[model samples]
Target: MSERQKPVLRVAIVGAGPAGIYAADLLLKAERPFQVSIDLFEQLPAPYGLVRYGVAPDHPRIKGIVNALRDVLDGGNIRFFGNVRFGTDITLDDLKRHYNAVIFTTGAIRDAELDIPGIELLGSFGASQFVSWYDGHPDVPRDWPLDHTSAAVIGNGNVALDVARMLAKHAEDLLPTEVPANVYDRLVASPITDVHIFGRRGPIQVRFTPLELRELGELRDVDIILDDADFGVDESDERSIATSKQLLVINRILTEWRSRETGRASRRIHLHFYSRPAEILGSDRVTGLRVERTAPDGEGGAHGTGEFREFPVDAVYRAVGYFGSPLDGVPFDDRRGVIPNRAGRAIDDEDERVHGVYASGWIKRGPVGLIGATKSDAMETVQALLGDQSEWWSPSEPDTDAIPRMLEARGIRYTTVQGWHRLDAHERALGEAQQRERVKVVPREEMVEISDPPATAQPT
Candidate 1:
């Protein structure tokens, strides 16, 4: 059959984040046998997912990922529907009614739990929450508490470093970035002095990338403190570092910071390796962090040496990892915090494939890897979705206008690609007046108003 004569391959992608967008891009560029039509549904008024709301605003290099996402959305082939949620706003039934298949890429944004004594203390926080606040995520509260003088961050990854850097760096330094006004104010009022990062392994085994480890030292007036005892690596550790370039750079950065002089800077970021958090110390709130000292095991790992000590800090932030939330109708793996999928195709407890249903990104796999990794992950899902064309959904109302009409009748107040452009310009204008790159709009209602104003016709 001719391409136009065949039924269009209508696909609905949930979560317009990097994975979903990349999946859409790949499908559009794929050598398909039939015509395709894609619709990207986003929960937030703005898209780009974590890159927009999970990254540190101060890191413009990482934030530059938005530009690439924007290019794909602006291509005009894939339709974008912002402020349209997946579970409640539009259910799996709703998707099946409009498209031949659906792909879920709702990446994990919630912080993974750090089970320890006193972890529930009032002053303790999750690094993902702090990151969302600093990134001006509309869902989180505008104000973040920063009244403490000293804080402890748990974990050794880039997020742990970003949290420490944002807390330790002066607020004035963030003026050139896209930090929201409320975040800037809260940071400027912070009384933080010392921020300690705790890692459960030796320096060579840390999860930090070279660039993130290096960024810690570049902080203007903040001192990077390191303990020489953490660097006592045996022949096995030395050989591991020598073979892997990632380990080599990370070790080099730590070695450089360890040799640097301290006590002159206004703020300090102490890197404490071989320390596993045993408890958060406080009666009512976070007053200190108790950690157990670990010694290198002969192979390459570290084990608790039964020695414990407490570091005096007013607040604690856990940056261990991110966990996925369960969707309304999707089958989720509670323990793994992801959808049970085999190569991007959703599966049941019996391991039978759930036809026409898909998952990608952190929601498909546990939260791991950088944004760049999602490209290959997304391709796996797109290929799975395209290969299963025989088992596609038979939509009752496949007309493109049916959904918009239904949403309008139900007063859903959904936004469109034009709405995103409007909101983008508004944010830029807000920043242009301040001579900064851009100023993020934080409130959901205000963002919706600016993007899809009530006075104007509904954006379709």
Candidate 2:
């Protein structure tokens, strides 16, 4: 941090997700003679996108990154501009007009569509939506229905397992967590007993981790039904594989299931392999789904065996993955399903650097990997932004704290970290009062209402 070393560059980072936060940290660490200031913007009033809204509630240790990131925000060099949205309130021109460079780290905000016939039915929803709903997303429906004897999650990834885990959790188990109070109440009310997770590929290709896979056995009263036929592994996979982590994990769970015969729970959580969802069958609402059986191609893939099976289910969740949104200023590639960039450098249609523009995280790489991956992804973008310091940070106007006024004018209510602290305290108090962990606010209105003061408190 020498005078000659401190580089004076003002950077605007869109989306306060891990990628954006990491990029801001890198810019500050550069410590060039020029001042490196980062203005981080988030569409939501709160920061920490997926870390707050995506990760499963039981995995609080994994979300410790939020506190680590809170340190980055408290560094004073990074100004948080929450409740402000890109592609709406302001355009890329407005940001480039003020800051030295703009980094778009807005992660894939939307989930991939299943595009099946009955997908649009009422009971069918994506796993992302379910996760967001239970995690207390302001945009999602508060009073959702899952009143059924059985549910089916259509995917074999970790996300699908998370959905099943949430559904299977004894109401008493979730009572100790930070899950929204209303979501817990609704989940407790759900009569669901069976949760079947389907995979087009065999267990060897399943994407869930060994620890997460083991968590399936911890459920109370939930019978983990398995078929020996589905456990068949390809012979070629044995030699071509580096390690048998996936098989070992699956076998461990299978072994545990076999050892225990009688004392398990009355509910069930079944893991089905080589079963592809061919169609969703429901009446005015979803009643069940049609599944097609498949056989291994011996090359670590599966081919439909032309046999079909149907299961009666009240709800269905597709947990495939997520994709990026098209920002007004950024060059998006539909083929790649992300913003067009060269090693985090935002590139134009003609394959040239779009000056003063960059991208990182899921929007740059397409939704994959854990929170650790965003650090490297963001470092690349920050390095590129540091390359050209002169093009940015020449302020045409003095700084104005417009966030408060803009929110007032647009009728957009928000929650400051202090306000969030207040809500947090209120929830914790409520949870303690009820002898539970913490009751979370389910709807946006309830959250905003708790964050803001009464109308009488405002100055006339």
Candidate 3:
């Protein structure tokens, strides 16, 4: 066949998150020589991986990104295959045989390990798991333990703030949000009154954004507490804060909170800086957290000052960071918790590029950047893939229809884009009855059943 008449460039993106969707959008818009066909596969029945399952329900601004992603999927140029597990339903070999190239945009899901004494204690928990539970991820249990009256959150990032805020906020205040019914019920009965957030570094070194930091103080029925001593900024810290507007804004917010007198609120979020968790104190369940005082190391880091103090708490949640999990047949760097890749191209042990295989987003680069950063990351990966079109795998039969046929033959009842629309509408309808935005469906079976109903069922 001639170059002009050759088959369309069939690409399989093994993730339906912002990264994968952005990849598809970039590919469709790229000034390529030939036509392309994109297919996005997701493990869940619904699309928008992190937006639907990772972001806190109260963060409507962050969740608004889903609308743009939805526009890309509704453009009628790409196909969405939901409830399709990458390793189990389809293998790397299956993708290589069917598509010209495959891009893995499966972003990080698990929490980075926190090595400390008593980390395995009964009341100790990973922030990612707790976020998943509160966010209504189908993979997590419907119920979460909210028995702790006072909790300690260990981290300096936005996620730590999210964990702390959720723990301290009144559950009824979240009714207008998209929190699932079961999660709301459990949160309503929570005994949490005080949440202490610990950060090892100084205030300027914290990773939370200015907006997220400001929102922490805006929570209803919650008092934002910060020790005046924790706001001590050296010349170097002031210089660093001056260079970045975001850092300056965050510092200002913290300073303002520190200047305020302690309010009489039902719930409290105590923000502590320069305190490193030496150990989680407990026998079986968490009883307290032993922390060490740390001073600036002259550089941007901190060093222990041989001073320690313990805070009484019922539970401990570590929101250090998120780490990517390894795929069944992919090469992953265990130490870094990401796939070993060179500029979006998957690299072998010897650092050689694996032809027709690529990666993007947190899976490509370790979990660091935000949602906006994933778009540029996907662009780089897609550009690299497009540039290497000459070396792409030339499948004998790159039929787009063949994938759905294969999936049907295997008895995997996958969901399509149209099905997702139905599910979305269903949720909206349920929310309307309650005079709220939307109520998320937490169960995987219900999601699939709503999206892809049985043949005997009547259409809505």
Question: TM-score for each prediction?
Answer: 0.97, 0.90, 0.97
**Rank by TM-score (best first):** 1, 3, 2
For 65-183, candidate 3 gives per-residue lDDT tens digits of 99999999999999999999999998988898889999999999999999999999999999999999999899988888889999999999989999998898899989999889998
| Best-performing candidate as measured by lDDT | 3
Q: What lDDT is reached at residue 264 by model 1?
A: 96
lDDT by residue for model 1 over 247-350, one digit each (tens)? 98877777777788889999999989889999999999999999999988887678999999999999999999999999887888999999999999999878
Which ranges in model 2 have alpha carbons more than 4 Å from their true place? 1-7, 240-247, 262-264, 390-395, 398-419, 432-437, 445-457
The Cα error of candidate 3 at residue 214, in Å, is: 0.6
How does residue 96 of candidate 2 score in lDDT?
Answer: 60
* Model 1 ranges with Cα > 4 A deviation: 1-3, 453-460
Who is ahead in lDDT, 2 or 3?
3
lDDT of 2: 0.78
> What root-mean-square deviation over C-alphas does model 2 reach?
3.1
Better of 2 and 3 by TM-score: 3
